[model samples]
Target: MNHGSQPEPPLDTPFGDWLRWALVRNGYDPEERGVQRRFADASGIPVATVSRLLRDKGQPDVGTCYALGVTLGIPVMPLLVRAGHLPPEALEKEPQPTERPRTPTTEEEALTALGVIDETDRAAVKSVINALTAKHRQEGTS
Candidate 1:
């Protein structure tokens, strides 16, 4: 596996259905969850769509698959590849770079070049930093 990529698994038959079951079962609660709520929360998919998928098994579509993967915190590539929806090599391909590595004139210039914001609305940046710092301080020296 690459630094950022996970190995695509070879899914057994009934993989897609099983995946949904696994995700929901892993987070399952006996009385606290309905299929719509669990499916939406687990897959980041719309609850209605989840219901539609459950109702119309072949109609869930890409959005449903993608949402389920995202919500489950598993990459879509692995699932698709495993399920024969995508070629295995597709998962290993790196995204095309839009530009070359930037070369700064000096070390300090390079460090300074890495800015969190650039003409973007950053009103809450300080607040987030402060909150993070407080959290870190609370955690102490690990």
Candidate 2:
């Protein structure tokens, strides 16, 4: 993941920022050489499209956002919201009178339920989860 000497320029748009963060979270350094092509191949998006997105040169379609999310193991809703294809309110849950709300059973589910859509926040939460899981495993072994 060595990106060499050139630093990555700041992503001006929210979607661009999120895409860059998600790429890093998924172990793809945006600054690394051939990252755009690699990510495009992984996500099944065209290399040119991926390049434009990585460079923050154009807007992405909903399908592109969903494809990237799937490739990154992130929920597509957040991507859609960040890409402006959907409003922030789209992520809010509506009450269902017939069914009771179920608690989140996994880290991803918990993050989604808590609306922790920011990639930075998601990474922090994942780090804490990993630390806690490791500590618990150690304690159990002891």
| Top lDDT prediction, candidate number | 2
Q: Give the per-residue lDDT digits (tens) of candidate 1, residues 2-80.
A: 1123233245435545454544444643234585676576557776766555443444456655765677676776666
Candidate 1 — which residues are off by over 4 angstroms?
A: 1-9, 29-33, 41-44, 51-56, 82-84, 92-142
Tens digits of lDDT, candidate 2, 36-130: 88998888999899778867787789899889878988777767767777777777853356667788998788999999989999999999988
Which pairs in model 2 have colliding backbones?
none
TM-score of model 1 (CA atoms): 0.41
Whole-model lDDT values for every prediction: 0.56, 0.77
Question: Against the hidden reference, what TM-scores do the models get?
Answer: 0.41, 0.56
